[model samples]
Target: MQILTPFKTITVSLFVLFFLTACSNEEATEQTNNTPVAIESGDECHLCGMVIAEFPGPKGELFEGRKSHVRKFCSTRDLMSWYLQPENRPNTKEIYVHDMSRSDWNSPSDEHMINAREAWFVAGSSMKGAMGPTLASFAQKDAAEKFVTKHGGTVLEFKAITMEILNTGSAMNMGSMHH
Candidate 1:
């Protein structure tokens, strides 16, 4: 009975240790998944091959899988274009967009990137991005409205954005060639 008691104690200790380890591992993984990735210079747009740092408007990034595979874009339009394709949308874990309200139009920077899902986008704006029409994003609706007043655009929530809207805006920008 004494030997059996020690064996049972050891078994219970092992189980508790295993459980704790698993929980810690899960917490670590969750943190990793939620953390934002930094964009670096020379990172080419996944769709356009343009160096992302050279752009002056909204930029985008998509992260996928446990490996956190990233696809960076020089423009939000290109990101949306890439996302609308059926093949690229399935594995996407998170999407990020540059918050134009936080960026300097004269010198755009990736430090302004925010969660694309939570952002408010202004389409049909006068601003031109790395590609054509810029999809300016803001963390607040008031900021988007201010952008609309200044640049002439329609404010849209993330979920409300559609491929047709993006296409139309891009076509309009192309027609005007603001850049």
Candidate 2:
């Protein structure tokens, strides 16, 4: 029979502790990796092929459950344009957009990203996105209303936004407006 010395027991315990910590860190990394990824310097919009970083507005990222790649968009408008299509709706695991209330209009940061479906949108704002006209996304309805007061647009829920609104660049025409 073999008995572990004090030094051997301590070393073995430390090795087990280290191994457990490493496994925990790995799981944390995997979970965070599933979340929104930062746009690189040359990342192109999945819908437009335009450089995402060059655009000045809230950006978007879509994750498909069956696919490993994340679809990046230069503007929230373009993201909705693609997402609103029937073919693209299925298998979507997650959708992220910059919270305009928390981010700069000229250079939106990934740190302020929020779920697109839960956000309030301000369409036809004086602010411009990657495209000439874009939807300004906000996490709160009051913020969206304040934006409308300042930028001249309409506050709309995610579902209230329609293809017609995107096409016409006018949320006022939608009839169901918060402002």
Candidate 3:
């Protein structure tokens, strides 16, 4: 075995340190990406600026960027409004919604959230949420159907919710509110 020079030893040590640090950073990033964020009491809706906690219904959140930055919404409708806008549609990693089946509308929390991509939403319900007519998200298809049975709405998946549908519901709700 050859004796190592000081420079070689230092270089080897530095290489090992760099390798370890890179592995650690990758693990940290994975964990952050997989974890869902919570909605705090003072969190405001990105679209309407309403205090999210004040709403007694399902809420929405979008996670974007490498850092997993969150944008909270007072209602599912507002979240859709923001998502449908062309300028706001890039780099979105995940979309979340409060599952009405699991949520305490009186006191909303992160535990109630589910991935909007896989969720079923009840729209055009008689119930008025934070901003106006809002879609209620559910984790299961049966739960969404059950909600519609009691609340009177159409069950729709995330992709099926078109801008026209949203606009029509919003216009109807807004018109009725003033009457």
Candidate 4:
């Protein structure tokens, strides 16, 4: 019989482990792709940037994947508008635009607030010559009240700011997003 060296055994084990890990990852990814991911309450909508509330029952659109009006355009009309005029849409990836329930802009996840919109901003904050829309969103109401109080700005529902309004870089000037 041929003798196997310790180094060879360890190498074999490592290769098996690596192969198993890769397969597991692929399986998980495949399962995710098979089904539409439901947008959860805390997650920001792809279109409106509004945060879904835990008790915001029977409102907004609910697509097969739980898509909604404020979150994903609210309607086929909005979605088509977005697709046709891509430039008009805000950087859905960079900007979030959450409703503020409180003014702190500090601890956002507090339960005291019921439902508020917030804009989670990061990318456009540094854009030059007129920064793009910057935001973070929330589903807590009290949070919105508190946010406007300290930040000193108007509080608007998710529908207030449309893709057109946001594209002008106007909301960026709507007082402070500071908490």
Candidate 5:
């Protein structure tokens, strides 16, 4: 058997390295694709077609799959509505919502978006979102409790949110009744 010359050895090693790097980059790109995308000016709600940027309160972004385009929502309510559907639940890759504790209720910032699964939500607050009554998302439980004390909402975890709360419009009316 003939041994490879130094030049040939170098070329083969470089080719292998290049191929490995390309594979690694592709994986990184896939992961990055799941990261939250900032809502644009003209971005419309995936469910209602409302102009997302024009609305106040926390917004949502959903990554359905590794290659799917993010589904944007004007309010966290809309995001939950979509996610609660039987067909969408199994396919969900990622869900993001603004941390209202770190964002303005009237103009949520993209930099404050957090993993929705880990967020605390205040429902039935006095605050109105894109869809009228909306769930105010927070990153911490204490922040949620503080908001409830001030805004008149019940603090709930992600799984605690239900379709009944969304459909009845009671979340919007909850704290308002006391006043």
Candidate 6:
């Protein structure tokens, strides 16, 4: 007589498949919920500029190096038009930003977060015009320090985009359409 183990084999395979699918789904959900979108440098902002945090796309970044300061932008048009200007530009090449993805408090960094070989910069604004709180970034600590020394600007980090910074002198001016 032969043993009937065909049913047992099929049951084992089904259980394995179900278990794998469940595990992968849980992992994906957890990752999505736990991280912010990645930010890039070159892409234009939804507002202003043609470089850095002002370049267009889903996300852009700005930095004023002296600290590890990094500012992530949301839209190209929103960022560039009001963000980038020679007067608004920080005077240092130490600032490094990306233009590949978007980021925020919810999605700060990612697995492939350090994409900087080809980076660009754009200016920034708190509101319509008339300037806002300017931040600086640096690649090396010493370089950033030198910049702060020469430019008289402040040093900052990537994790310091607080309401106080964004609200300085009403950076959010929703009144430019009448012009």
Model 1 gets an lDDT of: 0.83
Q: Residue 105: error of model 3 in Å?
A: 2.9
Write model 5 residue lDDT over 60-95, tens digit each, in one string. 999987576689999999999999999999888889
Candidate with the greatest lDDT versus the true structure? 5
lDDT of each: 0.83, 0.87, 0.85, 0.37, 0.90, 0.38
Candidate 3 lDDT over residue span 15-123, tens digit each: 9999999999986865654446877889899988888888777888898766677888888899988888777677677898888887776665678788898999988
Which 10 successive residues of model 5 have the least lDDT summed? 167-176
Q: If the candidates were sorted by their lDDT against the true structure, best first, what order would they fall in?
A: 5, 2, 3, 1, 6, 4
lDDT of 1 by residue, 31-59 (tens): 56544567788799999898988878878
Tell me which of candidates 4 and 5 scores higher on lDDT.
Answer: 5
- Assess every candidate by TM-score: 0.78, 0.75, 0.80, 0.28, 0.78, 0.36
For all predictions, the C-alpha RMSD in Å is: 4.6, 8.3, 4.5, 14.7, 5.8, 13.3
Candidate 3, pairs of clashing residues: none
Residue-by-residue lDDT tens digits, candidate 6, 30-69: 4431122444545433343434343222233444334424
Clashing pairs in 5: 124-171
* Tens-place lDDT digits, model 4, residues 79-129: 323533555344322112222333233323223222212322121222221
For 29-80, candidate 2 gives per-residue lDDT tens digits of 5554357889999999999999999979889999875433699999998999
Model 3 C-alpha RMSD to native: 4.5
TM-score of decoy 3: 0.80
Off by over 4 Å in 2: 1-33, 170-179
lDDT for model 6: 0.38
